[model samples]
Target: MHDERLANLLGAMALAIHDVMLPAVVDSSGVGVSASAALVVLGAHPGLSVSELGRRLGLSQPAAARMVDSLQEQGLVTRRKGTGRVVHVGSTRRGREATRRLLAARSAQLVDVLGSLTARQKQQLEPLLGTLLTALYRQIGDAERVCRLCHRSCCVQDALCPVGQAERSLAGG
Candidate 1:
């Protein structure tokens, strides 16, 4: 059983981030969530197969191919042959620039939201958020999907990234 108050607050926060914040950020970046997500994933992992991308985005191979076609048409992504018949998808320079803009917009929105919290309040919230993220990764079992558009640069550099640590442990590393 979960605490009702906490659950409600979390739900509200999710709504704010998803409905309010994300839409606003996406509007400024001129990229929809799905396309932006694909771009971000491509930026993070430069040479994923279309099938692998489908797995990450919870799309079927055909759907992923359609998405790739759309992105390619938009000059946002490129596809190259890999070993065997695999086609590796990568972001183009234009795609990377779009990703940068998307990330900046998201960061600006989050910064606006976080600006309301006091320094001490933010300090107190950090570990709690990390714990929640760790639990989410465990419950969902998909780190890449769970954090598709995450701009927490710290996660890339920090040894304490809960998702990274969880994934490493789960992989028996």
Candidate 2:
């Protein structure tokens, strides 16, 4: 049987992290969670269609369109006409800057949270977190959604990302 105490601690820790992380990301980007995610996604993969963006963010078509409209109004993103009725969304310079700030804020808050951990503790925690992320990717089955707000460069700098590795493994690659 699973340990209830472990589950509870994990849940509490997840909530605590969210509480610390969300405000920093939102304040830096001046957008709500979904919009912030959109900007991050766009910053990474420019010119994704609205429908695709919505799918990545787990939003409905109409909702995604409205989000695109709002972002355009904020001068954070631009929509260009694609072939036929498709609309491709890309980040503006301002949007890219916002994305950078959002990532920086997220990194700062996370670093602060990890400040209490010893270097040895952090080293130990890295593999544990990677294992958890891999398991999470297996369950969630959507790497893009799982990493929507992630600064990909950081995760990929040292080695292959655990989630990506999970994805590749699942795909039989």
Candidate 3:
């Protein structure tokens, strides 16, 4: 019974992310899903090294570097000198604006899809989603990768962030 429920939930999440979120953001922002994901991560955690960015995006080092180059060319990101030959990447103002627009569009799409749900149903879904996200973050063990495309504004305050709390618990904090 649990397995069936898990499978169904996973399927729904996959469809919502791949089908609904990606297409809407693409249409509105003219950014591919991967690039937008990268932007979202950078927006959330600035000054990440290229390797870290690549890790978050599940890209190889070379591929990550190339993506950073692309982002730099588009004026969406900037690279700054970090300690001891490390280059840290950060989103430019343009990148932040783009990310904001993409997230807004994504939220609008989600609202449209869930608009029929009663307020009570929406309230009930929040805790369930948080629990699921926390569990998934624990299993994945990589916060940036897991949350690369998440809209930070929707996250419960930092104190209550599921992924953040999951990570802290794992760290024995």
Strongest candidate by lDDT: 2
After superposition on all CA atoms, how large is the RMSD of candidate 3? 2.2
Report the C-alpha lDDT of model 2 over 68-96, residue by residue, as the tens digit: 99999999999999999999999999999
Provide the lDDT at 58 for model 2.
95
Candidate 2 yields a Cα-based lDDT of 0.96
Please give the lDDT score at residue 171 for candidate 3: 94
List of clashing residue pairs for candidate 2 = none
Q: Against the true structure, what is each candidate's TM-score? A: 0.92, 0.97, 0.88
1-173 per-residue lDDT for model 1 (tens digits): 56998899899998877776678657755666877888888888999999999888778999899989989998999999999989999999999898888888888888888999999999898888888988999998998888888764746674477887788888998
The candidate scoring highest on TM-score is: 2
Decoy 3 TM-score against native: 0.88
**Superposed Cα deviation of residue 66, candidate 3 (Å):** 1.0
Off by over 4 Å in 2: none
**lDDT score, candidate 1:** 0.84
Ten-residue region with minimum lDDT total, candidate 3 = 152-161
lDDT tens digits, residues 96-156, model 3? Answer: 8989999999888888877878999998988887898889998889987788878877886
lDDT of 2 at 96: 97
Global lDDT of each candidate: 0.84, 0.96, 0.85
What TM-score, to 2 decimals, does candidate 1 have? 0.92
